[model samples]
Target chain A: MKPRIAFFDFACCEGCQLQVANLGEALLDVLKLVDVVEFREVMSEKWAGPLDIAVVEGSITTKEAVERIEKIRARSRILIAYGSCATIGGVNGMKNRSPLEEIRRTVYGEHAHTFPTIATRPVDQVVKVDYYVHGCPIWPPEFIEVLQAALQGVPCFPPDHAVCVECKLNENVCLYDKGVTCLGPVTRAGCNSWCTNNGNICYGCRGLVSNPNTKGAMDVLARYRIPLELVLNKMSMYNACREQGKTP
Target chain B: MRYVTIPADKMADYITALARRQKVVAPVEKGKGQFAFEPISEGREATLTYIPTILPPKKFFMPQYETLLEYDLHEGQKMQAVVELEEMVLFGVHTCDLAGIACLNTVFSDRPKDLNYLIRKNKIVIIGLECVAYCDEYASCALMNNHLPNGGYDLFLTPLGDRYIGHVNTYIGDSLVEEGGFFRDATGADFAALEEVRRRKREVFHDEVPIDLDEIPRIFAHSLRTTIWKEIGDRCLSCGNCTNVCPTCYCFDIVDKPNLDLKSGRRIRVWDSCQNERFAKIAGGESFRKERSSRKRHRFFRKFRYPVDRFGKFFCTGCGRCSRTCMARINLKETLAQLAREYV
Candidate 1:
């Protein structure tokens, strides 16, 4: 029987969902292996029945999101948290850095106190996630690999090393040499050093590795004479939740 | 052994002749003091005098990504082993890089031979260029005893003022010299110029690190539990950049990439690094080198101790790529000198 797969989002840019949609001809090939029962972005069809696999694509930032993600966990056999938002709370987690009231006033202005929000938490923090497709907007190749593994009942391994590995393999000149402070030395791999390839330093959108050498990363900053506040500010963008002891 | 000389003016013609015979990969400046081994159709594109390319010529022998086998599910697990290769001439390889290739050759050519690497290595010809002076402060080639040509190339070129003294090491080099017709018989004057160049180089290059090459293994043996690893590990980002750019580091991981149909896939080998957390991870979720310091120590031992014990030679060719490419500025010479001070 084809696995009944569904994609859901809570607090995200929906760019990861667009990546799946932008799979071009590969999406049709993937359809033959699994039955995508509910993909709100690409289809109008929605299934409330039990799903074999549920691919969630955002951080849980609201009280309703916490409840909905638990329901997803209860219904699906395998749950995948994709993108930086779904897996690591992403930029949404940056909200937790400042006072909630002040942030609301800044964004909603007069509409403050009307919108109820909670600290951003990853899908894994709410419920168990069986697999992960990590990146800001997921790399399409990794998405396919993760999907294949999910379908075959096998485990897919994401690179636990730093982004510099892939960056070096791509033969791109080290960003540090170009006077750019990159978070690649501590950032998790699997994005294939996407940012560095395009002549941009890594902002660590995929989040830091499982066991990052943060001290070493700081040493790199010091070696290049880059300011600590600059890198720390960049780190807070997608990793504030992880830093604040929200998720493991 | 045959000797030939190519005048400075005909250097371009010599390279053009080589390119005309086959695909030629030579150093081309990438601006901002960076150079890369790129294919050039014209002789003028080859930058003979430059520091080491970002990646060594190991890219040609054992490519970063190499497909090992193509399997098809249609015929009940039909598989065909294959090796991707090209016939070409590699030019402007420095002595340090040539030593790096020699180390790789020793590894892949060892018992339980990697037929794929062996097959591809034979297809390419090597032309080495002597480094008259030190590339930079990062290089420790003198310490590694790789500053002089150790004969990993078919033809070795030594620049002496207006002409290049070429040492033809093999039949291939002799045939090239004869076929290209750009080289003339090496006169006694040219020989004196070559000797003078070598003499001058001897004075220029010296052990950058304070330790002797012979004492490296002894120091490494005793310094296994030294605090230097911890100190370096504290600064090492576990980025795997050090090993990736290393010429002698040949570790790789094999993976199967199934096509969209999920019917068949091609199994390929891609470069892997020991510094990676998962590099030492086992099936039951146990990582041998769990601590960053241990992984850091392992890399040092691989270069200094383990390879010397196994291969009877230091795996480190001292190209200084590991130091040069390190994001954390973990200087190889500094590390080695510290070890020597502690244990020697």
Candidate 2:
């Protein structure tokens, strides 16, 4: 029997969920391997069952989002954190630095008294994640590869290198030399350095590499005479979860 | 003629002649203080006197993404190994990059040879340009013995007053000289000027590091567990920037891309880096070099230790790309000097 697959989203633009539909022709190949039982973004059918694979996108920013993700973890055999928001809390985690009550007041205004919101965190903080599909809007190639791996009952993961590896392979001129700061050295690779190849520096949407040398990264910034605050800002942009972990 | 001269004004004429017949690729200014190799339609677009391109000529030799085979699943695994080829003249190659290409040649030409690289390499004509002074402080060509012209290039051009002397090192170079129609037979006085320029260049370029060439391998052998690697690893983002910019670091990973129908797909090879934490990881998740310090040690040793033993010479061409591109500000020359201090 083909494994049942479902995609769920919360507190995000759902760009990562849209990547599934964006696969174009390759989506047909994916259809042959598994049945997509639920994807609210693309289809209308909301069949709920014991799912084989559940791909969750976005951060648990609200109490309601946390309950939904915990339910997802219980129903699915394998749960994947898809996109940076799901895996690392991404840009949503930036709110954690500010008080949640202030953010609620800013967004909801008079309704802020009724709506309950919490400090933003990844799905993993709320429930176990068997795999991760990382990026701002997840690279389509990796999404397909991971989906294929999961279907075959094979475990897969991202390359444990920094984005600098892919940037070099693409033969891009170093942004650092151009006096622009990038988080490539400490961030995990998998996006194939798309941001750098597109004439921008890496924003490190893929979170930090395992065993990251944070001290080394700061020293390097000092060597280039780049202000330490600039690096701190870059790190907090995507790796806010890691920063929170470091302190607490 | 083995040696020929092109008037300073006629340099463009030669590039135009080459461009008319085949694609002529050379360095072109990208932005402020940046340059890249690009195909030129006119001779004037080629910048002969520039620093090393952001990418080495290796882009043409072994492309970052090169298709190796195309397969169709519609039928019973029908497949065909393909080689992509295009004729071109590579102008303004540096001596250090020449040595880099030689290192790649030695690796790919070994027993289990790469036909794709070998076949494509022969399709391009190499014209080497000599660097009179250091391109920047990052270069250490003097230490790698690549400051002087090596034999990898078919034509070696040296800048002389009023004209450029082109050494027709191969038959192909000889043919180009004859075809261009602007070159004149190099007089004996012209050769003397070439010798004088080279003699002066030796004074200008010297070993950028404190260590001797022969002692590099020995130093690496002794410094296996030194804190120097730990020091470097600490500052390393493990971004693999150093390995990626390295001219001789040719490790690669293969990937396959399928068409929408999933009936057909192409397999290609992209460059990989050893400094990556997972480069040596196995199926069982047993990583031989899991620590950042060990990965850094492996990278340094590859250039100085393993290649010297296998290929009978150091793999590093001293192009300085690794140092220049490193986001962590890890200077290759400084690292070598420190290792030398520890070894001695």
Candidate 3:
């Protein structure tokens, strides 16, 4: 029997769903591999029943999102965080910079009374997430691979190694060696050093590696002559989930 | 075993003959002491003594951009895994680059082997050239223990006065000798000549930096909290040149390039750098090492500390490419010295 697959979204750009569609023909292959009973982005028919796999995107910000996620969790056997927002609180977590009330007032003013809000957090914060396909816009190959693994009844976890491993394999000159700073060492792999391959530095989108040598990455940047505060600010961009203590 | 002489005059004959039989690539002068590995049909095009090429021979094993799979949307998501490879004799490879190749071999050959890389690697033949002296002030091969031939090649050649002393390492190399007739077995005298070359190399290739290789990881370990990263991060433009030029840096990104028809595309693996700002950013916009200092520290630990713990060896290889290519004037020796000073 084909595994029942569903996709859920919370407070996000819904870009992860677009990225899934970007998979083009691979999307068809994935549909053949599993029964996607509930992807709002692609399907009109909605299945309000139990699911074998639920791919949840975006971060939770309102009470409704939390309750909705709980419902999805109760019905799904496996929950896969579909993007950085659903897994790591993502850029949405940046709102943690201010108190929840102040942020609401800043955005809504008098209208704030009508809108309910909460600190944004990844889906895993509210429910048990069985797997994660991490990235700003989920890497299609990784998403497909993890989906295939799930279908095969194998546990699929994001790679724990740093980007340096893949960078060394590509044998490109180090950005630091060129007197530039990079986040390859602390950032998780699986994005396969995407930005770096195109002559851009790693922005740490895949999230931090498990037990990353944060101090070590700091020293190398210093040796390369990067400023400490700028580096901190850079790290703070996508790390609001870990910083705000919202990560499960 | 006998030491035979083929005068320098007949060098072209041997090279042309080799090229005719199979593909031959050698370091050719690009300009101003700079050289690159280019296809060579004759010996005159080969630069026997050259600095590390603009790009290491790693390009042969893993091209900057390679297609791992080709897919067609016209026929129900049909895809074919393809490998573009050419059988060639890579001649004039320096000892340091050979060591670089060995590092790559260790990586791609690991579990879940990269079939794309392995299949391409099998088609190429390595012929290493000995470095009698320092290539430049940037090289620290002696400290890294990559100055001498370390058996990554099938044949190693040492220049001996008017001729070359060739060490055939594999059966394939032996077959080349049997077919080419340009090489003869080495005698005791030739072996002695090789030893003399080694003795001379010891005098020429002293440690470029004063720090001990074994203590490097420790120095980096203890100096993590030091202000060196802050200093370097201040100047870092986040250009990612250092990772791009590094001999062992192999981070990559995979993407599918769809055709104009939007029906067919290929999954390409391209060279990636960790120095970029977006490398770690995931959907929803969370970045791990956002600081330049953190990213900088990560690169150093990867070269000096992390790999040592994981692979039981330093990943730096001391090729000096990173230092030479850095636009920020980041000196590897100075960085190491500063770390050593702070730790000690």
Candidate 4:
């Protein structure tokens, strides 16, 4: 039987789901391998049954989000964290850098009391995540590769190396050589060094590697005369949750 | 085996002749003060004097990504070994990169040879361009002994006052110059001019780093537990930028990508780095080099100490690409000088 797959979104722009749509011709190939029982972004009929794979997007930002994800874990055999929010709390976690009350007051204004809020976290904080397809918006190549691996019973994961591996492969002039400070060395490799190739420095939107050398990252920033507060702030975007010793 | 001259005025004609002779690939300005190895049809297009390219000539020899095998899963994991190669003449390669290519050849050609790299290597011809002086302050070519040509090319070009001398090292090099109809036998005066340039270059290209070349291995061996590693480790982003820019760092990992049918796939080898946490990880979820400092230490040792013992030569070609590309500003020369001070 074809494996039943579902994609769920919580508190995100759903750009990651758009990435799946952006797969273009490859989407046909993806469809051939699995049954998309549920995907609110693409489908109207929601499948309510045991799912072989549940791909979750966005961070658990509310009490309701936490409860909905609990039910997703109960019905799915394997739960894959999809995109940066689901994998590392992503830009959604930027709110975490500030006090909860301040964040609520800033966003909800006087109605802050009516809505509930919580510290942003990845899916793993609430339930076990079998795997993660990570990025600001999920990387299409990785998503397809992971899908293939699950169908073929192959072990699928991102390279343990940093983004510099792909950047070097592209033979791009280093950002540092141009006097631009980049974060490619410490960021994970699955995005294929896209930002660096396009002439911008890595913002580490995909999150830090499994075992990030935070100290090493700091030393590099310090050498460039970048302030520690700035580096910490940049890291706080996707790393606020992970730096606190959480997993996805 | 022989030296000849390509008149300075006819350099453009010489490059055009080389183009007609074979597939010509040389350095061209990539705009905004950047340069890369690209195909050229005219000498004017080639930037003979420039900073080190973002990537070494290693890309032509062992591409960023190369397919190692093709597999069919339906027939119980049937696989076919494959290699990709093309013919071309690489011109304007710097001396440091020439030494780097030689190091890669030694490593990939040893015992369990990497036929993929070997097969791709032989299809291309190498022509090196001399660096009259240092390319930039970030280089340590003198310490690594790569500032001078060491015979890794079919032909080596040295710029003289008004003429360029070609040191033909192989029969292919001889034919290229002899048949090109642009080069003639170099005179005794040309030899004297070449000698003069080398004599003056000795003063210009000083040991960028304070450490002696001979003491590098010993210094690394003794400083295994130094606090320097801890300091660099603490500051390092573990971005692996240093390894990617390094001409001699050639670690890689393999993966398979299935086709549309999901039954057939191609296995490819992509570049890997020791700075990564998982590079040393095993099946038991235990990583031996868990600390960033240890990974940085391994990369340093691989270039300076380990390769010297195993390959009888230092893997570092002193290209300075690593330090230049380092976002964290981990200057290679400064690091070596620090090592020298710690153990000298």
TM-score of the second chain, each candidate in turn, equals 0.98, 0.97, 0.95, 0.96
Best by TM-score: 1
Which number leads on lDDT? 1
Q: What's the TM-score, to 2 decimals, of chain B in model 3?
A: 0.95
Model 2 chain B: lowest-lDDT 10 consecutive positions: B256-265
Of 1 and 2, the candidate ranking higher by DockQ: 1
Error of 1 at B107 (Å): 1.2
Q: Each model's C-alpha lDDT? A: 0.88, 0.85, 0.78, 0.84
Q: How high is the TM-score of chain B in model 1?
A: 0.98
Which candidate comes out best when scored by DockQ? Answer: 1
Question: Mind giving the per-residue lDDT tens digits that candidate 1 earns over A1-248?
Answer: 88899999999999999999999889889998899999999999999999999999999989988989989899999999999999998999999998998988999999988898988888888899889998888999999999988887888878888898998888888777888777888888998888888888888888888888777777668767889999999998889889655443
Share of reference contacts found in each model: 0.81, 0.78, 0.00, 0.82
**Every model's DockQ, to 2 decimals?**
0.72, 0.55, 0.03, 0.58
Local accuracy of candidate 1 as per-residue lDDT tens digits, B41-91: 899998888988888888889888899999999768899998898999999
Which 10-residue span in candidate 1 chain B carries the lowest summed lDDT? B173-182
Candidate 3 residue B138 C-alpha distance from true site, Å: 6.6
Global CA lDDT computed for model 2: 0.85
Tens digits of per-residue lDDT for model 4, B55-154: 7888788777889999998978799999988899999899999999999999999989999999999988998999997888999998888898999899
Q: Supply the DockQ value of model 2.
A: 0.55
